[model samples]
Target chain A: MSLAHKGLPFDRNRVSFKEIPKLENGYSAKVPIIRDEDKLIADSFAIALYLEDRYPDRPSLFKGEGGRAMARFVEGWSQMIIHPFINVVILMPVHDLLDTPNQAYFRESREKIFGRTLEDVAATRDAKREAFTASLEPIRKTLLSQPFIGGESPLFADYIVFGAFQWVRVLTSYKLFDAGDPVQDWFERCLDLHGGVAREIKAAA
Target chain B: MSLAHKGLPFDRNRVSFKEIPKLENGYSAKVPIIRDEDKLIADSFAIALYLEDRYPDRPSLFKGEGGRAMARFVEGWSQMIIHPFINVVILMPVHDLLDTPNQAYFRESREKIFGRTLEDVAATRDAKREAFTASLEPIRKTLLSQPFIGGESPLFADYIVFGAFQWVRVLTSYKLFDAGDPVQDWFERCLDLHGGVAREIKAAA
Candidate 1:
């Protein structure tokens, strides 16, 4: 979304490993690798921050101390709580919980690492949802009174939280969040700013 | 320590329930609060970033994209992995997970709401550590070449990682990290910069 918002004229390709012919110099099995000029940056945060710094005039992703702190807090919170919860609850269940051949490797990996049965993993999905809701309460309270998490303008914090919320909304039956009037309004404003790739990504998903 | 490095007259006070008698009105019950003039801020990262922003001339706590990204990554990573792990492994074991008097009430409420047990919480901790180590291997490999995670100077990433590592080093016997040569050198550099606040914090612990 940050890339799309940059408004740069570059070739955007959505290629999958199975679709491409195998070759000696074939790309590694990594998604969303951005090749800007000579730099090939991996990792979403790295790419986003790099783009924000490179194109300062596009929009202020990180603004004041309050905004920056909120941004960092939300980014960390989502990565820690929201993303993992969504993965365990929605992705793992739909894709691998029933122990299909394609998911055999993942099942084995989960057992080796976590010492948990498929049922045990599935059972914790509700707890994950609860923890996620608990963590978001403070942020939601703040957002309910203000337009954005940082107040007034949508900053990097909104993007990070929006990404995680969007993932959960698309993937799960959980409807734990009610950002309320101010937050809902701010979210609409954010959509106006960086909704292009976000919508596209969701549509593809 | 950032305050101390700035030659500011700031006093460190350890506050607890028992120490309420010793603390003044405004300073009471705030376990990890910092007072600078009329401003008071809670949370470690918030304080660290605030100090850096307030005292820009002391030394660059966080710098360019590489530095900032590395710092943010470590900060996010610590909150994602270490913070929750600490809650389960150390805090729960010590019977002081939430640091509130309403533990029984909270436990009852949680049980009623989510039906989660201590064992379930512990399992999440183990899972988090496994996932963290798996994700961190790439970061560890990246640190092999550079004297710091970002290179040369000890960026805020070093401090962020150090803060969480301190907790892990003290609380658990999990050998998930080794400083190695480059990381060790960078660690030393960070210690020297802030008059060894990282060292002091660990020592105090």
Candidate 2:
């Protein structure tokens, strides 16, 4: 959505390890890669920041000091809260719901890394979810009072948070967000600005 | 040391909360406030960014795109890894060692919020520390290959990571970090830049 908003030529391709030849470096890579001219970049945040920096003439994804602080706060808070919470509850279960081979691999990976049973993982996940949701109250209160996180204009903070919240909404069927009237209006404004990419993604999913 | 390096005034007195009256708004009314007359800012990151923004004549703390990405990555990683790890292993124990009424209040607040016993928190913390340290292999590799995190120049990323690592060094006797020769040399360079302030803080402790 943000990529499209930045007016960049974004090519979305789904590739697997089998599709690519082995590198001389001995790493079998089958990840999403973004190419702008000769520059090939990896990592979501890295790509986003790179685009923002390269196209400063276009409308910015970040603003001034307050905007930067708010964006950082939201991004940092999401990593602290939403990422871990969603990983435990939604992603783990979704991985299990996949085919037998993938599920077996997932289980083995979880056991090897976390050293916990499926049931134990689920219980711990639930606890984290509860704590994360409770922690969102402060953020909710702050958002309720503002049109956008950084005041009147919607920025990258909204997109980053909205992305996380969308995943939670899809997985849990929970509407744990209420950014109040101004924020609600600002969200619609963002969708309009991004040429309804948010709606398109949500509808597709 | 960051405060000192910026040539800001520091409050000399450390007064008890009992000496001040509480605000009707339920927030701190008479708490000690660190002030910079030139720029009115509160948060450390805000202050750092503000200094970078305002003092264009001085070399920027955050450089360009790669520098910004490096800073954000380090900032996010430190919050995700270092803070929680040190809080559980070193901070909680040290708080207990202090055995102050304020420390007890802090423990109670954490318990009520996170719903974990101190020992449980500590163990969970240790596990996170191990995982974080293991994950740092790639980051260490990157740092070892460069003079600073953003290449030859020390950016905001260096300072942000340094602050967290400094805390760990202070609170615990554990020697967990080794980013090879270049990183160690960079660390010494940052300490040298900060001058006697770092030494003074350590001496005070």
Model 1 misplaced stretches (Cα beyond 4 Å): A9-17, A20-28, A33-57, A60-190, A195-197, A200-205, B5-27, B31-56, B60-193, B197-205
User: Could you tell me the TM-score of candidate 2?
Assistant: 0.53
* Model 2 CA deviation exceeding 4 Å by range: A9-28, A35-42, A49-56, A60-84, A92-125, A134-165, A168-193, A203-205, B1-190
Q: Specify the highest-lDDT model's number.
A: 2
Residues B1-205 of candidate 2 have per-residue lDDT tens digits of: 3454455557655444343343223333443333456434544566666776666666666554323433443555566555666566565646655547766766776677668876677777645755656644434554544555545555566677677656655666665555554444555676666554554545113
lDDT of 1 by residue, B26-112 (tens): 553444577778887766656767887788777655553223433444554556555555556553543354466545644565455
Give the C-alpha miss distance for residue A25 in model 2, angstroms.
16
Q: iRMS values in order, in angstroms?
A: 9.3, 9.7
lDDT of 2 by residue, A1-205 (tens): 5587587667676443344333323333533356788777664555657777889777666653233333443565566556766666655545645677666766776677768865677678644655565555434444444445533555676676667655554556443434453434554665665666665545212
Top candidate (TM-score): 2
Instruction: Provide the TM-score for each candidate, comma-separated.
Output: 0.52, 0.53
What lDDT score goes with residue B104 in model 1? 63
